[model samples]
Target chain A: MLTDSERERYSRQILLFGEEGQERLKSSKVFIAGAGGLGCPAAAYLAAAGVGHLVIADCDSVDRTNLNRQILHYESDIGRPKVVSAREKLLSMNPDIRVEPLAVIISDNNASTLVSGCDLVVDALDTFTDRYALNRAAIRNRIPYIHGAVSGFDGHMATIIPGETACLECMVPEAPPRSVFPVVGTTPGLIGVLQAHEAIKQITGQGEPLTNQLVLWDGKASQFTMIRVERDPDCPACGGDSRASGRRREI
Target chain B: MRVQVKAFAGFREILGPDIALELPEGSTLTGLLEGLGRRSPGIQKALFDDQGTPLKSVIIMVNKKRQTRAEFVSRELHDGDEVAIYPPVAGG
Candidate 1:
């Protein structure tokens, strides 16, 4: 049921996935956490790709320091909330898609509600404190979570499907100590696009997801390595006896 | 016995991509790490803290399987075994 304009807008990618795949993109809803470096590019790509709805949540206002990597925010948006800045650019990028920007922090209390009814969740947050909350919510909701993080010239990403693969806790058992991490913009830009690529493939049924595998990107050496990973039976968040709702659809 | 050591990210800068460590047969994981420390002080500092304890955040894997901290200290390395060590990046 694509309109003539919808068909015209997606004509290029349609050559790759066909009209059916484009419809999948037009019907999917994605919940992206954070509006920082990783989230910025991820939202931009997913928005342009015509994901029907993008629910982006963030609490911080734009700072002068964020310009190096947060592409969605401009100098004029210096003091605006991140979600507000991101939403403006995303909507303008593609008016065909819907953008729901939530101006609030995602914590243990609100994580589940924020992700409810979404087809997938993207983990673009910086701290494990908030990441873990989204992890728990994704696990409870049985939604696939695409996890990505970058530091300096290095970055890593993986997809987590509850009950089928290693959850985030199984891979990163303890949170690393937080610090003022130094980073160049390209690292996040690359990893974020990889995340968006995974999301598109997941929704369109085009390719295999990076499940039970961790992709490590070392920009300095210009190398990509895949490390096999597994679920921990005793993982506190997704351990034994924690059942992913059987009714939930598999990706 | 010969074991392969693979390092990623910052560790690669110190130990290169792969190092073949010659160890006496029956060396435990701790012994091998300590031997590596003796070979390079920079790696020792990155892998361990002031008290010589392995940093809690650095992940250690054996033949692509993640090893528990307790297992890391107790497991023995055999010939041709591959051990990986790296810290997961936490930016963006």
Candidate 2:
């Protein structure tokens, strides 16, 4: 039940989604897998939108170089864990929500446990190894996952509804080697916000998520393109006879 | 056949947003990619390795439907078809 203060705090957005939707947000638990550029904006919006619980995990510290894109970490936060800084700002931004910060790298060993009880998982990591790990864990947990990534002026996001849509590996079977990729702040900022928007829709059961299609953002031309993604029978993650995947999702 | 090609991300930077390519009446996706590769070495380097195999990391779609690398060699393109190429980004 929303207290009087909780109702007033979310009155503006409540007008758009209504108290029922707001209550859904207040009851959802989200697991965000990074505390960097994408996570910063995604978590901030989810927090501001009054997601009842947020469990954020990241092992990296706030380096001076992260100041440009990781919005939650300030100059004073340099050398601190990214999740710690993010939790501080997220709580301060909306004291009504619960934020759990995990200061650890998301690896194959811990990924499933971290997301065990999450209603939804957000892939904001910078490496595909971690992304793949998180993807498998989400499948194992039967939790829907949101995948978002950006490099330079380009970024893409997709919503993965386990047993219902294509998994990340089904779309990109391989990945580019990890390196210090170049990225402008707004690139991830844009994609991350879209990710959070998708989360809200997924949580509140309000609108369409990016399921079975990738929305590619080209900052150069300021265009958004959607491309269909079909389920792969051999997709090692959510495929084959074991997956129980449904009919092909349409646009 | 005339195929409308759309490239996104780095592919867009090299091949521009959209390109119209004139090819034989029955052209394969690999043929279209080779045609694209002739215009920019970046396309060749990003989409295919030294052995000329399509990189699984690069996504190619035909008429808005995603196609895997295995499908690239066998799938034939029709005139007025829309082929899109993308490289998934990996930064947070």
Candidate 3:
């Protein structure tokens, strides 16, 4: 149920999706895994779109170096935890929505609990380790997960529908070595906004999510390319056999 | 046989967005990669390791379908096949 103020605040977008779709956004709970470059833009858009609740989890603090891309954090928030900085901005951006900031690292043990009750999970983390953890949790919970990453003016995103679509692990079976990757703000900014767009479409059932497809964004060439992907039957994450059991232990 | 190679991100920077390569019929993906590596050191370094094995992290797709590293070395290419090579970025 939208309050009178809520209906008025989302008037512009309401015209697009109607009051029902606006209410769908009001009822959705999205879990964002990072407050870095990708998370900032994703959360901002969802908040502005009137997503009912956002659970943003991050352990890092806002640093001077992060100011270039992590848009939610400003100069004044240099030493504060990223979730705190992001939560403050999101609430101020749209007081109608609820923002829950978790100042904790997302790990295998905590991933499931943190994402509890979320209608969707957004993978905006920089490390594949954390991304894998979130992937497993989403599969276990049977929730859709949106994965996005950016580096050096290039970024890619894919939407995972648990058993229905290729998962993050299924697509990238091996984790790329982690390092201090170079990136321009626009790289993640573009991809993150696309991710938010996918999320909005998902909650309101508006448009096609990037299901079974990887959308690569090249900032240099200024092009978006879609590649078809299929779930791997041997994938350790959501393979056909494992899909039946819903629990498989790695030997 | 003629095939089109579509490389993305860093690969595209070295080899351009799309390159037409001429290879003997039934040439394997490894052969195509080796041919690419011979053309430029930038692509060689990006796609292969010092030991000459395809970097495990680089993704190779044949006609929009993924080919794992093992399959990549063995899968034979046909005329007009589209091979996509890219390194998935990790930064947020």
Q: Which candidate is the best by DockQ?
A: 2
If you score just chain A, what TM-score does every candidate get? 0.95, 0.95, 0.96
Cα misplacement distance, residue B53 of candidate 3 (Å): 4.2
TM for chain B in all models?
A: 0.93, 0.93, 0.95
Docking class of predicted structure 1: medium
Candidate 2, position A183, lDDT:
87
Candidate achieving higher TM-score, 1 or 2 = 2
lDDT score, residue A71, model 3?
A: 97
| Model 2 C-alpha lDDT per residue in residues A182-218, reported as the tens digit of each score | 8899999999999999999999888778899988898
lDDT of each: 0.88, 0.89, 0.89
Model 1: how far residue A174 lies from native, Å: 0.2
Error of 2 at A20 (Å): 2.3
Superposed model 1: Cα runs more than 4 Å off: A240-251, B13-18, B37-45, B48-53
DockQ for candidate 1, C-alpha atoms: 0.67
Candidate 3: where is the Cα deviation over 4 Å? A241-245, A249-251, B38-45, B49-53
